[model samples]
Target: MDDNADALDPTPTRGATRTRTALRRVPFTLGFLAVVFLLGLFTGGLWSRLDRRSWYPEIAYGWPPLTEGKFWTPVTGWVFGLTPGQYLCMAILFGASVAWAEWRLGTARTVLVCASGQLAGILVASVTVGLLAHTHLAWADRLAEVRDVGFTTAAISALAAVSATLRSPWRLRVRAALMAYVAITFLFESTFADLMHLIALAVWLPLGEKLFSRTEHGFWPRTRREVRMLAFTGLLVIAAASVAVYFFPGNSLLGPTGDERGSFWSTLLTVLVIAVVADQLRKGKRWAWWATIAYGVLHVTLTLILLGVAIGTDYATTGAVTVGTGLLWAGEVALLYGGRGAFRVPLRRKITEGALTGTEPGVAVRELLARYGGSTMSWMTTWPENKYWFPADGERYVAYQRHAGTVIALTDPVGPPDLLPDTIAAFTDRCEADGLVPCLFSTTAAVADIAGELGWRSAQIAEDTIVDLPALEFKGKAWQDIRSAINKATKEGIEFRLVELADEPFAVIAQVRAISEEWVGEKGLPEMGFTLGGVEEALDPAVRVGLAIDTKGIVHGVTSWLPVYGPGDEIRGWTLDVMRRRPDGFRPVIEFLIASSCQAFKEEGAEIVSLSGAPLARSTDTADTEPIDRLLEGLGAAMEPYYGFRSLHAFKAKFQPRHEPVFLCYRDEADLPRIGIALTKAYLPEVSAKDLIALGATGH
Candidate 1:
């Protein structure tokens, strides 16, 4: 089965159909907004402040109105806004949020949720204010006499209810943003509307899952990226709260705010500091985590002390602001502690145990690979971006990249097979000691078996396409495409040249760079790293570059090959890496280059030529795939339009090569989330959040 098929199954016609269906699905949302709009227009509340009207208090809901037997206030309140600005804001928020909820939950369910939530919020807030009115709580007492109108409470409730249907990362994000909005607004600007909003959210947030969720994934973060996002959201909420109070502070549910409670400059400085630390937290920095934890503890302890003093002395003011902020801090601390594994990246780079220190790790890795020869991907270990960990014997090493607190070993150890177990064990232990998740990517079955023996789980992530040179021929029907490509290249006078890229003249190198850059410029994301190399990697003397040039020496296409070594420093085969072609030049240039390159290598007595494993692309699927497999399948589909890894995997079938499965071996499923993030970073090391957001916006 095609694993990525389901992800890419939506056609343009199907997408248009879905869009049309969704537009028709939100009738209740449209009706609700219409009712509010028409009511405002008829009552002149859209242009003038409703409070200025003599009959406003009769329709606005609050404790005083409810106690006076104005039982119709709650229903009437939903149809009016206080002013034109409030109408506009409510229309925008309600249109977007209620429309979305209606689309996801259907019109009937949405109507039920919004109506019930509106009534519940009005009653709860009024009752709450009524209970606390004469209890000397200044904020509640002041709000008890006031009334409010709007559908904001209903809008928020609908959003919270639909949050149950969202998938991870977004599910957490929307909920956090909603909670932060209500909490911050109520604490610093406790309007009756804000109190109703908070009440609606509190009541519907947990209950929504039981009512609306079709499939419930656990609430905890499932990926390192989610953990970072949550941490960032927490810090951002803190900063937002400080900004809110500084700009619009007064008597709130949490007592006095702004200058009355703290200095303006101090609040600004605190916000700036928190903003910086929050960014670091998003990057999973260990030092930032510690700093945040300490900040949380300090706030919690101070709040406790203040509460103790108030309780002992019978003080009327309970320092409610401090207590609320302390509670927020406590939640942040709990989140940090639970996801501590995501924050193991240190403030400074530290050497792993038994890591090469005195000499260049890349040089050591290359020498070891040359001396003892490893898997098809062993040559990739020599890349400059990798770090090498040596065993006690100093003869073996594993090349890995540290990202998102994961030690992602690229392939297998480059040493004797007999020492494989020891090397794997040592690496795992070192990662454990360093508090890093350990995993191997694009590794051989031997390594997977070894990892399994050490209690690790393995899943096939890609298939390495290998063309046995001795058996390769273009004489049969299966080789029709290859033969046709070669014939076309010959007719066009496309000459093939294989040489060390770095030895080429400046003009040739420039043309090669231009071709590669043009290819990269077309991609939505930057050129990938890790197992995938580029023109720079082809510049290595040991790597060979295959060029398709016309009679006039205009380069049409280019390909790079890394030598795969066997025992005794023998060059056993070549693994293909970089492949690029001029978009306007030679339609079959890639096939021609590969076929010619294979012929050249075969003439040199090389046993096989590897097309290399296409990242996140599998040749086949298993019936009993795990959750991780499905996750990867979805990721592959999302990335297909940008990177086309699955397309490349399919194209390699033209060569009729044997497929060798490559596995990603890890300690357990718990580490898969971090591993996924680490792999993304390793592949797109230069990708920024803006780039990712843009990519996602493309719906790929």
Candidate 2:
């Protein structure tokens, strides 16, 4: 016990070891930057000369020394900055970028990418400045002697390089934000530093992927039509923003003259061109990619030309603003052109909304079911409340009901096992296309595992009590309650009889209906359907009905069973449903009926008997403590007194049936609330909001 206690202690040595292990796991690039920054801070101005220039000889990469001889400037300049603020900023940017890039591309490649980007950007900027100075361009002449000294360029380059390693949506969002910030900066406040940063990003973006090619595919605007719509939406936002700025008072952001005619026409032409490209891209036109790329190039070129003209004509108040405009355009160009592959999905033949909604599971669907079999709840697919979705192959199908923007499947795909995955995919894809959330309620574990692959979350709602008929016997000590109930019923001359209700006499059927009506009335709620059954489902020709009857043939209780069909239409099992007991009859009649029915099924060579599930009832698996689970627990409590679902589950436990967990599976955790509401509606479609609210007070 002392040894065990000692082992459990979080000792200082153990803590230190853990800390060291975690530190070792951190990317070396990040750790190095952190150490350097701290040391630099402690050293005060030791790294700088009296002239406010870097004390390191290799720090001059541009301006004063544009020589290729200063080969170490690209590497050594990364560690030195003009001010503490610049040093701190570089530390933060490089720390994040290098850490992420090194973690993804490893140390050697990250070093190569950063170094190459820095060298390329410095060389390009210096050469451009020299050429422009010879041409007498005032903007270039002013920038010619501006010493570029910071890690901002290389840091941004690293960021751009690491972006290609990210998955979609995130990849798209990060690249967009990075490029947008850079472009906007250059557009509104173009500086020599900004130009070099942009050059660095451009150099690094393509190189990252060439070295480490990884792709993340997901279904967002999963269809071609969605891509087209997204492009049009983008166009609208741009036009609206442009128009708002153009008409604003004292706004010379676009141009000093503020020529509304040219601006409006130019904006319209741009929108038209974008719309055309989007449509062509939707149709899988190869040239659309290049056309959009050219547009991006032209956009950046025009912005630079305008900035140069403004500077040359002396209309540019601040070179910063002109540079900002140029950078913003450049960033926009990179983002717009960098994500070319995002629109490469081959266009599928257009599926009309009418065809999607009107599709019915016909004869082929029935044949597939007979061939492949399905779950106990699969027969509920024929219920009028559900809509069936069949894949084009008609080999499998899923039934669902839509409410409150959520399309909830009643169970797993109920046809061929091989086609189950594809059927679910098709259903979810349709939901995505129509902008509806898809979910599966009361699904089996196998189906839940399949949904998990599609990134679905799950909550255990109830457990199906399946009794093994072959192993069931009334001799065990645990079977005392069931045996006593049977004995009492026998002494009272009540007989248990299983018969098809369709062949029953009119009087028997009427009595059974009266029992069902009384049960429904006692609940003070509508007759629930979906997985549950009422008198209507019990009356089906194929459903077997069990009756607790007296010697006089008067029925005291009735329980219906739906046959669980095997691959060859053989009745391998039975699912109990539509349990109704007479108000004034024998107290133990329901128990006697269930026990006797199990015995009868055993005699009939059935392998198992399912007592079905109590809706909204929970099991012992409280491992998932998500808010959705808590909310569901509260909901179950709210309706517990009225429905007694948990009580029913407890009663079903008397038989010692194996508890098979049933789950409600859904795509995306963000939609769990909507899914909860949809499940409520699916279970109690006829109950009004007021009725549900008043339920707690009435306690039926």
Candidate 3:
């Protein structure tokens, strides 16, 4: 306990550097057990006999127990195994679990949890067996005769206790798996050891808080509503397993003698129950939570009554199994009752913590992007239409816009590469909470893989054309088209001029505006904006607008570029945005303007220039024949006649730029209709569906 202890906080507050805080003390628990195992190996079966000798007195709760005091059994039993295989198994589990637990909970808590779990589990299991045996229950004979001399009970319990210190959904997954294993073993295996494992779990789960609260953040299902959902989900899982055991002969504790038809129908009913209840739990339906609680109470009561009758009629061979099953049901019942307050939220409304940086989301995100920088779409986040979602640490952000009841994230999250997955999860969680479909739009293939890990699907939607400035030359045969356009513009006295649009003269601004208006007028629909910008966007002083102007000062073609930023405010390159031309002025005007812009950017120390991506335009790849690909292809075809995204892409290809595929990552295909509408709104915020359909029919 010193100033150094303060730095051991793994997830430090903002502005705190993450330091690798090593354990203050080495975990001696595993080392000590290794020594004992070695000692037992060298003792020629002496320690094994000593282990049996000590067990006789300690378990007084068992029948025919020794009167002589052998108080060391509880502690010594873990040290001496009857076989080398047993010792080796215990050693592996003990070493890994103890070391990890000690690192997280520290040495003292780890040792205390393990020791207390071991002693309490054995004593309680022995007592339960001994009481049943005194009453002459059929299956109780084996429990009093068995010597449970292993570290499994303690190790598993310690693992469970330490897991409470972990975060979700990993924590939820681990705890669920551990509970399932113990319950399944007790129901099917029906061994004294299985009972001991359950007892160990039961003992350690509630006692973990006393040992350590260092990792508790109260961010998970600690709420009353969440606890109730946990109860319902837990009960449903156990009920489903119980039904499976009943149907599958030889897997049941009753030794497979039940009626097959009865088990089959019951199992089917249980499965249906599980499906309904689980869905309800996920949706946070309070009525379903209450229904699950009612089911648990009725199920446990009926099982206990039937269990009593079976034992009374001497028909029960494994009464311990029945009792264990009853305990599992009763545990679910207690959990439901305890978490009754947790089921308050309705199906549509969800809870949220709001902004990650404790400031206005947009402002905080802008600051983050300015400091860290991002990919090509990063500048789009600064667009007035977008909102931001950040992870708990505020290290990254998912820039998104709301459309068609879906929260569509614009590209993948931008920030530290390592935090992308967690940031995606946090953003998705926020969307789910707000009752909106979550999706990632225009993400890269690598980013798609990250979303795929979260059970999302990806479809290639567009291809970005980027030119390597240093390697590009208009003199080559491949650049013939671009070369011709540039030479023709030069011969016609059309000069390439790069200027700050905001700093330009009023006449120049009026000319650029007229060219944009003329270009929109021919499209037969309203001017588009989201990922596509217009004159207003070009007016930013930081943006470099390149114009192809004739000697008489008439603007022939205009191209605006957004600075692709690198670290520390350095400009990496520029992305082409507003590319427009006066129809009567120049036929090869766009090509001339793009070629001139590239040369200017190249001369300014830029390495590459992105002609930008054409939305809904994808190159054919044999491997990418998914249903979404076809759907997007058809959609692209329908809009191509009017929007000409493909035509735009083909036009950009005249520069012979390298193409990079862009993807749309989403959670489910069912959201495609909404996603489609959202994408339309995002790209053409000013255009209406009626106008789009009219233009599509006209085929202009």
Error of 1 at 463 (Å): 10
TM-score of each: 0.60, 0.48, 0.48
Candidate 1 per-residue lDDT, tens place, 1-700, comes to 5869966877668789876776699878877777888898999988999999899989999898989999999999888999899999999999999999998889988888899889999999999999999875777789889888999888999999999897544676788889888877777778899888988898888888788865444355544445777999898888877776667767777677654447878888888999999999987787899999998989999988887887678676646567768877888998888776556554545334454556555567777788899888889888765777788666898888898999999899888899899889988999999999999988999889998998989988899999999877788898999999999999999999999999989989888876775566456665577788877679999999999999988999999999999988899999999999987899999999999999999999999999999888996774468988877777777788888999999999999889999999988888888898899888876566776776666545
Question: Which 10 residues in a row give candidate 3 its minimum summed lDDT?
Answer: 59-68
lDDT string for model 2 (310-414, tens) is: 757856443333343344445434533433333333223332344333343444444555667777666666544456676665456777877789998887687
Ordered by lDDT, highest first, the candidates read 1, 3, 2
What does the lDDT read for residue 19 in candidate 1? 68
Q: In order, what is each prediction's RMSD in angstroms?
A: 13.5, 23.3, 25.0
What clash pairs does model 1 have?
Answer: none
lDDT at position 198, candidate 1: 87
Candidate number of the best lDDT:
1
Better of 2 and 3 by lDDT: 3
lDDT of 2 at 142: 63
Q: Which stretches of candidate 2 lie over 4 Å from their true place?
A: 1-366, 621-624, 696-700
Better of 1 and 3 by lDDT: 1
Name the best candidate (by TM-score): 1
